[model samples]
Target: MRAAICDDQPQALEELKKMLLRIPAVKKVHTYSDMNNFWATLKDGAYYDVVFMDIDWKQDETGIDFAGRLQEACPYTKIIYVTAYTLDYVEDVFLNHANLSGLLKKPVNQEQLERNLEKILREQSEAEGKLLIYYQGSHIAIPLQDILFLESRLHKSCIVLKKQEYLCNEKLETLKGQLDGRFLNCHKSYMVNMSYIREFRGREILLEENHVIPVSKARAKEAKERFFEYMSARM
Candidate 1:
């Protein structure tokens, strides 16, 4: 796992970096005393699985504010707030929109850091499984969680994501076999990811970003049942 530490205090940043380096799962640890440098690196396409952020900063933009931007830029990257002002910012952190994983009060305890890392690692393991497909003469691995749905485009299959689509040289049935329980075949031509389902209304399933997929009469009952089952398991 690639990790990053964003704290204004040089000492605090170094301490956390040292602790993260000790963890066997963490392959790289990047420390930044300035949020600009961190954001610059992120804009340069640097990906970190988790970022330890300090709530307080000397600049006008607080860590929580920066984290919100980070969330928009990289929705999958987990954000863990490491702050000395935990009591003051705990409510704010929850209220703000971000991919929050865990919160740690500073001076960060090694045990607490490990606990957060363990949980994040477990989630990453579950989501890291990708669907390898041959597209445009290249084998591309798409993260399972990012896939919103699959559409049968005649002989070809369209892998739908939040903002992009990939046409794979395979049938929908063949792709369905590779997917896990989170996917529900709502229609003969459509397999919707239950995680992206916003609501199941009548003969249509509404997904995130207001995309709608049809639910065939034959598969309607089973699709609804599977959707509920998936939601219940997550709860």
Candidate 2:
């Protein structure tokens, strides 16, 4: 996930950075201690999966006010008010924004943050909709429905169907956004289409077509669990 954080205190910003780094899914995070820079980026059509902002950020504009404008500028961005204030006061203001995800308290640790982060990303994935992938000098509409999973070679990621594969220039992360639902990343280089999976071995999955995808060391645990759950539900 690409994220932008707006907090006045440099220390607090750094703390949040450390916690975000622990989560494997949060790929890049940009820090903006100044509200002006935040506004400027929004005007330039900057896209971020999440925004962690201090509600009482000591700038000319309150974070809530800035969030209101954000609703129109980048509707896909999920805003989380990480202030030390009660959410009751600004409930309606944040709700006015297009995609306000949640409000988190300060002094957040890894566990507390992860629970909130999980819920928000789950919704974000569903709300942002399926992403677009272009291939063969033409734009092919690969709905989240048609995909069973995707695997990457050095230069290209192959979109796997039951009987066909489409080659594209997108990276794993780019394809992840385009692929909807629990198309979990079971390998650093392999993102599975949960629908096609039939069963799991120690580190591989049996697809409906008997295709085997090797789950990398990094993502093996999560991948196995995800594949197990998916198969169990079907059985």
Candidate 3:
């Protein structure tokens, strides 16, 4: 996860950065002493999953006000206010924003930081339902729902989406193990996300892209049953 720390005090900023770096899941950490620089970078398209903000900015604008503006630019970004002030002073503002992850008191201990971070990471993983794959020497994490199906071409796997295709080095079997129950192995060469399935024609499955994937004769009955079960639960 990518994170940013915005604190006027340099000691507080580095302390938070050091703590965040210890977490294995954290990919990058950026710090900003000035809110203007932070906003400028975000406006220019910098992305951070979680932002640790100090409530007291020493300026006219408060962190709560800046967080509201941050929401407009990055609605998906989660905000965690690290402040010395009691929650009573900011509880009302915190409750108003659904994107705000949590509030940490000053002199945050390892336990408090890890607990909040674990929550954010777990929520992030579950919300994204990402499937990590390597293609063309680049690592890609695609949302599971975005993928329609996987088609085996020779020894490689071609990931089929609505408008694009990604060639992956992993085989169908390897990819199948990584996916959750939302995906089904319809054929030896085809593994599809049941959520994208539009219609199951005994011998094939029709997806959102109008792409047809063959259904193996052996698994046809089982596939049909599972599809209906999934639809019923979804409805």
Where is the poorest 10-residue window by lDDT in model 2? 124-133
Candidate 2 residues lying further than 4 Å off, grouped into runs, are 87-97, 124-235
Candidate 1 lowest-lDDT run of ten = 169-178
TM-score-based ranking, best first? 1, 3, 2
| Poorly placed runs, candidate 3 (over 4 Å) | 130-235
**Model 1 misplaced stretches (Cα beyond 4 Å):** 131-235
lDDT of 1: 0.85
Which residue pairs in candidate 3 collide?
none
Candidate whose TM-score is highest: 1
Is 2 or 3 the stronger prediction by TM-score? 3
74-146, model 3: which lDDT tens digit per residue? 5557898888885654775656673778888989787888899899888766756776666765557788888
Candidate 3, residue 147: the lDDT equals 88
Ranking by lDDT: 1, 3, 2
- For model 2 the TM-score comes to 0.53
Question: Candidate 1's residue-wise lDDT over 1-235, tens digit each?
Answer: 8889999899998999999999999999999998878878866557777999899998788999989888766556789998988889978999994879999998899999999999998975764578756677565779889999999996779999989999975667656645887888888898888999999899999999789999999998988888888999999
For each candidate in turn, the TM-score is 0.58, 0.53, 0.57
